[model samples]
Target: MKGIKFDGNHSYDAYQLFLNSYSIGEAEPNTNLVEIPGVDGAVDFTEYFGGVTYKSRILKMQFTFIADRFGLNAAYAKLQNALNGRRVKIVLDDDREYFYTGRVSVGALSPDGQIGEVTLTATCDPYKYKTKVRTATCYGHTVGKGVGTVDSPTVTLIHASVTNTGGAPAVPTFNGDKAFYVTATERHAGGSSDTFLNESESLPSGKDTAISGVEIPAGATQEFGFCCVGEGDLTVTIKLQERSL
Candidate 1:
């Protein structure tokens, strides 16, 4: 049967939670719908202004596994530790190459007979989920230099770091679509904040002067690139997060 693999440790497909290497079932993925209610008997519009809109979505899965008496208890014990309140990665289809991260809370363990079967119902909590991330590192980048080009793979969320490799200070700035800027002293590292893409209202600093909430769409490229001004060998590392959908 078709199944999904759970990865909490980034082991790829190695650590599927299925006890017998099989997935029993899954619930239909649901959309988190937001309904905007209209004022009753409003004079301006024909229909009520209230309509259902969609945004972040979530899914719940009920996976059952079977193991002999020898492996039953061990499997349940592993599930308890592996899934409880943990942000885990999931791969539903390898061909699709899509991944998702969410908090997994495993419900009660129901044992059928002594060790024949165990059913685990897990609820996935999600504000967002990510597919595989692509990372690139630029080393020994000099100041007052121009970076050639930068692009996003999807509606990507990116986190970047500029580490001072030399003895003196460096200030790095990336200007273009969804640009990022940082100012760091000697031997210090400054980068994008984790909340840079998550915080919609305000700009969060990455321990320096930077802008948060840069939304880069898929297949879009930034032509300007990032540059630095300072005394040290600057290493720039960038990580991009693509939405699972």
Candidate 2:
């Protein structure tokens, strides 16, 4: 069953939309060129500095909508109401483990009685993100690897619990580089099961200022080390989404 899932809803299952054919565009790199006065050629910033930027990719699909009891017009209306002009999480049947975030444009519906044909064009982000988020938990020190073609800039500190065994406060670091402090009010009391991550509100004051997060390079193992200003026991968990071209 070859089909497309938009925003976690399957096209075929929800609307009886059958995918006839599909095509994916190439991951074209965007060029950075600077024109200089009296220079023969434009200065290529991307080529000289080895930095690459990508434009949005396109995914086109041809689909046939089969109407049941409601009719073709009803089916078309339902499909339009669900997808048109909306940003969606696109998951193809061929690759269920990865997803692309994009906006879908539905073409005009051409109908022959109960059946109709239409085209869908998705303008997606350059990278295909892994569905599963990778998590690494450590008591004091641990190693974790990022699995993708590009480095992930948004790493989240999902959980942290620190107890100062010594006289001073403790600070934990992600990848032994970026440091975030734990306040006395935010310390774990060892009785409650509350979590700080994924909360609706912003992080506590002072805790959000220090930790800027770390960049995890693709396919490289990075060490996460936690050190206390005095002596303390710390447990922290971090998560990241890996993406590739």
Best of the candidates, lDDT:
2
* For model 1, the run of ten residues with the poorest summed lDDT: 194-203
lDDT of 2 by residue, 135-226 (tens): 23334332221222121233222343222222212233333222322221233367423222212222232232224433344554333322
Q: For model 2, state the Cα shift of residue 16 in Å.
A: 0.8
How would you encode candidate 1's per-residue C-alpha lDDT over 21-132 as one tens digit per residue?
4232332334343444684542433224432222333545555545555666776677677767776766564333546556666666666664433334434432223422
Prediction 1 TM-score vs. true? 0.46
Clashing pairs for model 1 are: 143-228, 154-218, 166-233, 196-213
TM-score of every model? Answer: 0.46, 0.64
Global CA lDDT computed for model 2: 0.59
Give candidate 1's whole-model lDDT: 0.39
Q: Please tell me which predicted candidate would have the highest TM-score against the true structure.
A: 2
Candidate 2's clash total is 0
